[model samples]
Target: MPSESSTLHTPAEARVRPVQQWWALSGRGVAKVFRNGEFVFAFVSPAFLALCFYLPLSALMDVYGVDYAQFLMPIIVLQSVGFAASSAAMRASFDDTEGINTRFRVLPMPLVVPMFARLSTNAVLLVVSLVCAAVACLIIGWRPMGGVVGTIGLFVVALIVGLLLGLLADGIGLMAGSPQATSQALVFPTLILGMASSGFVPVSQFPEWIQPFVRNQPISQFVDVMRAADTGSLTWEILRPTVWWCGGLFIAAVLLLRLGNQKVRA
Candidate 1:
């Protein structure tokens, strides 16, 4: 048998695989989300949004010949997406500030493992948020006029959009110095985009000058695609802008993530 000193000097045979590292980190993230009460907020936020907007504005929207519940579903889903992205940002910021990221860096894990793990956590939260939003929309009288395929397409669009947003937000969180800064950085854009978009009301309802912006903005484009998917009227023209926006978001996320990786290594 080897002496105690020789055993201590020997390299261990056991090695942690990259997939195991990713899974472990993802489990940790999911646990943190539950422990921090973010999971509860995932349900509450969308339901509250649906109630607040549908109650006050349904009659007003009816004046425009809009089925308000149907008109409102996309925005509610998108808002939930925003909520998930915000949570991701906060998680990334906390990891950075608390030195959790630095600790991970010192481990034998790949640089991308933690990022992918966070993305898995974000995806899980996004799915929950979308489900909660759907329940809230149903309670508010939204029904799927979209056939089976159309309805599926609607959710597929929502999922893709949510995942892209989560990626962008994750990068933002890593780049931000603190959780407060992360929240602040996300709040304005989320508010301005959500409010100013045709998501709440039609472009015709906006002031003439801003109507142009409202009609063409990325959020509006997303809303338009989702609505079209719901009604089974999605066309190349309706989808083109959203595709472009998704591409832009993807590029931006990649750049930010690369920068974040550099910062971590530094």
Candidate 2:
């Protein structure tokens, strides 16, 4: 008979195969989420919210020039990803309450499976929302400065940012007792953070007190970097701020995920 010791491996090896399996599980979960009417509603309803918000900005189109659309396009993508990522937290809290975690733990699975599965699923939803947004932008007369490739790059950036945000949200859901509270607590930050970008209005037009800070922020820099590849030329000046933001978020995400791991699902 094989020794019991032969059956054992380091936690490192035990975790490796499970992580790969977890990613495959995430792919299936995302496909399932797309089919759920309720989840689809959660995914697409925000574009409606945007149309209402865009009404006031319509007249500004004449005053600001069609150029405004170029800037607005990137903002919509960023906001879509940011908002959708928060759903991962809500989903996690709901699943935990439903006792989904217990069943998952009993399976030969990575404990991180459900958490990231929901997150990756929401990230996929954000991609759908972005395509819808691109359509809206074209219908409303928005044009990208860079062109097709540049616009696509902007979408990619939005997805990466959304992925990081979803990871953060998953951690948030784990620590908070209720999804409503966690979701609500996150709303303020989400709204305010996007405002700091160049999408809503030009930074040059912002009040003297607010202009300096928002202009220097990551979202604005990201908008510039992504837009440069399409509308303008790609340069370090445009890419640097986005790079910095992603780097910071990467560290914070790892730390938060680590903290959440202490909760032990069983």
Candidate 3:
């Protein structure tokens, strides 16, 4: 009795009831992103991220006599995390335009599954990219003095921050209507925040005005945490600021997710 097109809906699909099968929806979310070309480059991107951006900047900082890779490691970790999150947002946007989201809406799947699953998939991808960065660090003479705890902490921060950035990117994608614009929006914050808040120079290097503003900013705090972890330097200055930065970004990401969903669904 089914229509010819209805045959395309598997029996499994019909049985995946709403609330009970949220995880199944996540699987679909994961599948959708991998279908695109993004994952193909994820494994190698850390090398590119280092060669194209982190290494060059670290080399410049070598004049300070601090280890180039050491000084740069935290910054690189944060950058990767943020960039990864932005990619997540872009992926969400892609789903919207491709009609993937529409399909999900029509199905019995839970709404949260798509976003969360997409996020989870990207998280794994970003972690792999971070590992690639770690290998690059080894190749370029960087060492992690923070030992196991610091190393773990750095990656953890990266994942959280990356997830948020992705959400932010997703929101933008909803508004901008294209991948290119989503990418630009993602890159701008990474550059501005990365350069002005940390890595390029210490907070002391900035003028008194810019110093106060960024002193408590996330990148500065993240760099401080990373700097310490990379070199075994410890300070309260880094801890408090990083907590604020993480919390703030997390809130922003959640808010953006809500806003993006509304925009896209509307």
Candidate 4:
């Protein structure tokens, strides 16, 4: 026979539905992001990037007939997305290092509930970062050359890419063992891929030997597709590579997430 006090705490009280657990955890994550000043960085980073690049290189790019600000918008936006994803990684790493995930594993919720919550927090941050990026772009002379449909397509692509990147980063964080290690893991890929891609300059401007690689890389593909979408000239041929790259990223993210789950259980 249980004590009267134990009877007051029923099984229903002890066990929440997965959805409820997920929502509660998500709320906690979202609140933490705001409370910790991550929200301010979401706005500041894009603005800083826009100013740094647009001021120093705009004149040089003009000599080549490039509207540098307009040309730079996609990358700026992508950088903001990247920033959000990196923050997601940091959050996940902190949770892992602090044993929060281990505590969650001992709870009655499903294994995926905490991941879903982190993802939800990432989604919110992604959207905020995108909006901030757009505002930064506008300040630096980027305009929507794409009409309604094309503009919609541009953002849809960005959202998908951001979500996928966030998922991958979350897994990387979980596997990294420490916050500093997770950040170090992300730095090389972000810097190398960002600088090597078509986002910063025209593919034709690169050395002939590197042109093929520059034109075909995933970041380059995404940038070209985004540029085409911006100008209302998007075609299936232009978008095909982006689709494939995104598919590959999705697969990678899934595998990383699975590994992260296993690590938590261990």
Candidate 4's C-alpha runs over 4 A off are 1-16
User: What is candidate 2's CA lDDT for residue 57?
Assistant: 76
Candidate 4 local lDDT, 1-266, one digit each (tens) = 99988888776665757778988999999999999998899999999999998999999999999999879988998999999999999999999999999899888778999999999999999999999999999999999999998788888889999999999999999999999999999989998889988898899889999999888988888888889999999999999999999999999999999999999999
Worst 10 residues of 4 by lDDT: 9-18
- For all candidates in order, the CA lDDT equals 0.92, 0.70, 0.68, 0.93
- Backbone clash count for every predicted candidate, in the order shown: 0, 4, 5, 0
The digit string of per-residue lDDT tens for model 2 on 1-266 reads 66666567555677697778778878876766666553556536546645755677767865867455555667776666665667677766666666777677778886767666676677767777777767766765667766677667767777778788788777777667678778786787777767766777778888889887788877777676666766658777678778888888888777876776666453
Name the 10 consecutive residues with the lowest summed lDDT in model 1. Answer: 8-17
Clashes by residue pair, model 1: none
Residue 20's lDDT within candidate 1 is: 82
The TM-score obtained by model 4 is: 0.93
lDDT string for model 1 (1-266, tens) is: 89997786555422447888889999999999989998899989989999999999999988879999999999999999999999999988898999999999999888999999999999999999999999999999999987998889989989999999999998999999899999999999999999999898889888998998999999999999999999999999999999999999999999998998899899
Order of candidates by TM-score, top first? 1, 4, 2, 3
Give per-residue lDDT, candidate 4, residue 200. Answer: 87
Q: If scored against the real structure, what TM-score would every candidate get?
A: 0.94, 0.82, 0.80, 0.93
